[model samples]
Target: MGIQEIAQATGLSKATVSRALRGLPTVAGSTVDQVRRVADELGYVPSSAAAGLATGRQRAVGVVLPVIDRWFTAKALGGVDAELRAAGYDLVLYNLGGPGGDRHRAFRRAMLRQRVDALVLLSLVLDETERRELQVSELPTVVIGGPAHDLRNVGVDDHEVAALAVAHLTGLGHREVAYVGGEDEAGFTVAVPYLRRDGFTEAMARAGAPVRADRYADGRFSFAGGVAAGAVLLEVPAPDRPTAVVCASDEMALGVVVAAHRLGLEVPRDVSVTGVDGHEYGEVLGLTTVAQDPEAQGRVAARTVVLEAQGASPGPLPPSAARLVVRRTTAGPCR
Candidate 1:
């Protein structure tokens, strides 16, 4: 019913019940649990508006993303949602439609209605104008899958991930390696595609298996794009074709596998294929990859913002883990 009823049931003062309900750090853990049990027994429903009036916090977190349909974005979003829900915080999602979505309107300072206590951004590089607007809000902010300029980030190190993938291929004695990555799409501010590509190039150079200019093709970070890029790279003469191919995403890697089948090229024997991202389909397809957990990244981002919102100064986050998963698609070059 209300804090007053809960306080009576628990024999605790209304002030203690209120503090426990808000989950303030100053409240003792055992007392907080006792208050919650009594409150639940009394069917008490905490009101967000009342909480906001008391604490000047909206009890909500805003999540901003460029799109919603992709595998990584969706998974990360789920993770963020779960964490926020567990913390008794509402999620306010702000989808920017897609690559061509209205940038000016979304980042306008007036668009933020002061309805959220904090913000979690997913892999978007903000320009100067957008940055200023966020600064004006001054909400505790963190980015998932992105390490943009001076923003707290929660994701794998793109450079380290790329190098790990490349090292795996080169260790298998594959010298002629090709790369499949995309450019930042028009109206999109993602830095991952280029970061992975450059990391791949630099890793190859370090391994003494430098990639040729013609050996690289833009996969556009999609299945169709991967298929097209794979075809161009694999359709060449045997001697001229790369013995290994590294894709920036699992969707693209799966596409390359399809392209290989169509071109009558045997994986590992003809060309070893690798990818980044541990997409759900990757396991079924048996594709080797540098797997990083987007869902986990999302959870970390949400937790960090929630803590910061609660007046806790969390330290800098270490990069999320990324490890290579060797599967049937890659083996020592048999060519």
Candidate 2:
């Protein structure tokens, strides 16, 4: 059986029949369901090459993200893959290497060749030229983890996430708290680390806690970075050491805890620690943290772009939520 035969029998256009049978949202849901029923009854099958030529639509989605090996990125990809597959779309991934890896090459050279129907950008920062190129391409796009001009974005408020971590520590009567974070200013996409840092500083001031000069440290958002920052902060004599430390990410929080033990200090008893991200390790390490689900963010971003690619109009997308989780790594400061 063929599309024309199905269209003639159903009293629909061949174009409509072709689109509906393929599960493209360009057709109305009821019409699609009916078409599928007819196709099934007749045992009609679609030819892959003909369908592409007829619809001019690739059943594919492009995903751009950084650091594919990271837990957050992997989980986000998992969510994206599931959603796109359920919607009958394939995912084409582009991994931009870490800082200094020349991500612009993906935009300058590779992206145009892929001819994907839509794009989802996860935690990637675009410069002026790249942003202009993206706009000119006029592809259906969804942004995750941060903003892109006039595009739908899904993410947690970084400021609020950091504030949650600080509030948790301050509420426990810790007067001195430090922050371990990434390089918010250079070689990064958006100002996530900077926004979180600001949140911590503002929250501390509101709680009547002073962040001393020595209380701040900078490092990447990794276990090793956390360990380095942790050592710097905890190696101080007890009189000057912070009672609790807030980290920009959960991975860093775990590092700080290990640093505490190595320096002969007990968690919570000597130095309380908190971080952002509801990372998988948080439960195992008992690290208190402000939690946001990256997978859920990925799901939201994927759904948004896929629907838009299928011809649904774009609209407002509110940021995802973040909350605090208390665990064994934090307690009131030991006097």
lDDT (C-alpha, whole model) for all candidates:
0.83, 0.79
- State the number of backbone clashes in model 2: 0
Query: Clash pairs of candidate 1?
Result: none
Candidate 1, superposed: residue stretches over 4 Å from native: 1-56, 104-106, 109-111, 184-188
What's the residue-level lDDT of 144 in candidate 1? 86
Per-residue alpha-carbon lDDT of candidate 2 for residues 91-121, written as tens digits (9 for 90 to 100): 9887776666656545533233334777888
Model 2: CA > 4 A from native: 1-56, 102-105, 108-111, 148-151, 184-188
Model 1, position 168: C-alpha lDDT score = 93
Top model number, lDDT: 1
